[model samples]
Target: MNPSSTLSLLRGICAAALLATATSGGPAAAESWPTVPDELFAALGLERDVPANVLYDAVAARFHDQDQGYGKGKFADLWEPIAISRYFDPGLYEGRDNLDFEVQAGECASCHESVTPGWVHSWDNSVHADLDAIRALPEDDSRAYKKEHLAEVEANLRSMGLLAEGQPLATVGCADCHLGVNVKAGNHKTDLRLPDAAACGQCHVRQFSERESERDTITWPQDQWPAGRPSHALSLQANYETAIWAGMTQREVAEGCTMCHTTQATCNQCHTRHEFSAAQARKPEVCSNCHNGVDHNEFENYMLSRHGIIYQANGDKWDWDKPLSEAFASAGYNAPTCQTCHMGLHGQPTHNLVQKVRWGFAPMRSIADNLDHPFFAERRELWVATCSQCHSPSFANAWLDSMDKGTEQGLRVVEQGNAELKAMYDEGILIGQVTNRPAPPKPDEDAPGGFFGLFWTEGNNPTAIEYRNAQMWEQQLMRQFKGLAHANPGGFTYTHGWSELIGSVAIIRDEATRLREFRELQAKVRELENAADR
Candidate 1:
């Protein structure tokens, strides 16, 4: 049957009810349908009654398939959010409601097993589905190391006073993570929410604390950049505050920025859903999704390097389920994965990837020798210790020195390009500088449009020379430092780093010369025309 045509039938039912009341000599009611009551709307902070006209229009539109005369009552008022906030969920911003998982836990699996067979199937295979399986394994199990790790996690939970003494461990079912362990939180159908980082932290205390430590890092200059900034702790906020990300009208493109930044939202980005296997996240392939690109190609650099070559050849043979700390011996790994190198600190692996970060991919100015700074020197020493695991102390130190020198040279070249552009900008001779060039996106104070201008453009504002300089600083410089840091010699030299920097430098110089000559020529033409007229 046609959905829209049914709206007339729905209206007829309401009209008949109204007519019956009138003929019986009873007073007519203001509302004909029991949509969302005014009390419910008031509780949601919408401060308005559901209008009969809105109900009639919603029935005609057929917004939802099971249109119960008024079509998804709460969702019908799409405009209500504009007056309050961007997000429309009623209980979303409110503090989490406590749950009674022990009593209500089996309810979710029993229903979803039939409703969403796939969800149930995946959950059935996961360790979260049954902790008894882990407990049943023998003490001398081949993967006995993992059993030990689980014991530690269980003990940690007990220490937090969350896991009560003698309370037998429960399976980490849907409610355990999505809702809490014990209280009156509603049913799964209505109370389900997107679990935040804090929810995961509740159970996986060790991993959660390590990831959250990014907030307390003392790496960057505190006066300039925020302490946790350029780290995963602040990734989502950084995306939201980015000028181009906010200014762009294309919401799809903006959402792409959040794709990688979702790490701040959920553990599933790396761990993934259903299985959420540690072995899968241990592989370098997981990091490749976000880490490969023009700006920061750490994945590409690693793949091309000697370390990546070894992993690609023999990674499958190795046991990835083993802890990252034991990748070399227990896992039979000859070469380091991205996790082994970055997350591996002092022979132990951690979730805080930024703990030992120095010269964080792209530093704007010419930090000639970061070692001079005591904080950076300390981090370099930690890296030296990490590298010394495979190579001699002398060899590790020498390679670091080379990377530092290469980065210093790259920074100087970028600084020279910036100087040239700034000179043009100061002289007020840059193309479209005074006439057509509009300001760049907000929060970025680059008057000459260097870094922030690269994301967006207006007219000829960041003219040819300006664009060349911006690319040199943003893209080429990033490749140079990151390529060196990742131990990809060819990456830093010819592939995408040093060679690209040199090419950009030449282009900037050539563009600057041409622009100056063109400006001089225009002045000469104007002078010649004035003389002829006289």
Candidate 2:
């Protein structure tokens, strides 16, 4: 028989075995099953009296039907039957009411299967599953830390108001964030639920809230900071607050998840179809939606970098889908994708590179622990191997060293600038008397646009003007950084370099202030000489 036929035959045998176990009054009888222990039940927010065997039988039956006697077919199709069965039958597990859990879990899984199937599989492999076959082998210190940290994270979630007041953390499963309800005409309108901004915010509150506070006074950084200009500092702050905060429904905050998770093109926006590979997730383009602007120009930076240039120029000649080989020559350009630097390939018989590397773009320090194991100590060695994909080992090393040095120098400049600013502020050099402080007459009021007539206007201050200019300059500098990092020429020149020039303009304004004072002093001296002559 062919491999497919052989697989189908094996599945048939397994199905028969499952059926025999379920029906017979043998040792596998469901009635004699062990019940879920009170402790475990309590932890899962389930009733202790629940019978584990009944749930197991239901799950086994569903599994058998879905597999069709271990039939050779598409894995997704096979999973569908199991998903449907599990959704309809709550008795697939012990400890709790099957109906309630299944309803929520089913809805979440069904929607995600349509939108992000790969993520659904990834989540299944995640720590969420409770199957004995999938359990990690417990070592002494490792098990202890896992338990402690899990508790810590759960506590953190509760404190952040992501969970209900008395809800157990285990019960805070997939639905807490991903599910949405729509009420219209005093009846349910649509029950379409997908992971949205509010869902991500439940866990990533700090990231979501960082740009919302104290907008008016908070100055943009000098590297990307504005000098003498009018303040529009509150623009981003206002938008985020109004859209994410004041908006009443899930649709209101829909932009949040899409802003970071997708791009302007293609089905791969969430995850690629077919294999739904993990490799695609590590690419920078996935984050282009939100990071395309002046400050966080990850897309621009990656595109302009040597790696991006090489890929763009030569990708057609190489098999991008296959695992990268050491001897593989680049068609023309010399660099790898964002994945090359971060997620190492599987075929290369070296240490796991993804584990050891710390790409600290986001402030979150949470990382998968498998990377730190002793067996993966050669992660740095693997990272070096990535550089060798394009340039010689020596050249790659030197380039990285130079980049590091440049970063250090840039940081130093920022520190020095900040120190000077602090000194000036502390000495009260910024305060001054102005010649005019009059309240200007109001303009003739126009009719309200629609219903709301929200309107206001005010004259600008010199300091405020300078600050706004500095803000624009700051934005430009950030754009330049993105361009340089991504290897995108346009971003490097227009966005990144242009921002630097604007920043220079702001600096000139500061210098001009001192020059103006000097000119006034010279004019006074000339007048005094003329008076003496008279």
Best prediction by TM-score: 1
Deviation from native of the Cα of residue 303 in model 2, angstroms: 2.9
Task: Compose the digit string of candidate 1's lDDT tens values, residues 1-534.
Answer: 586557645644654454344334222121422222333223223333333223222222321122221111222222111212112222123332463223365587787778888977877877777777776765334344555445544544554455665454657777767666443345544455556555665555446545655645644753345566576655655555565666555556556666786565567778877777788899999998889887888899999888889889999899876667668855788888888888876677777777677777575453454456767778888888888778888998999899888888888888887877787788787887788887765544556636666667787767877777877878888888888887888778898777887888787777778778998999999999999999
Q: Give the Cα-based TM-score of candidate 1 against the true structure.
A: 0.77
Query: How far is 298's C-alpha from truth in model 2 (Å)?
Result: 3.0
| Angstrom error at residue 154, model 2 | 27
Candidate 1 residue 346 C-alpha distance from true site, Å: 2.0
lDDT of each: 0.64, 0.37
Instruction: Give the worst 10-residue stretch by lDDT in candidate 2.
Output: 446-455
Worst 10-residue lDDT window for candidate 1 reads: 63-72
lDDT of 2 at 137: 33
* Residue 291 lDDT in candidate 1: 92
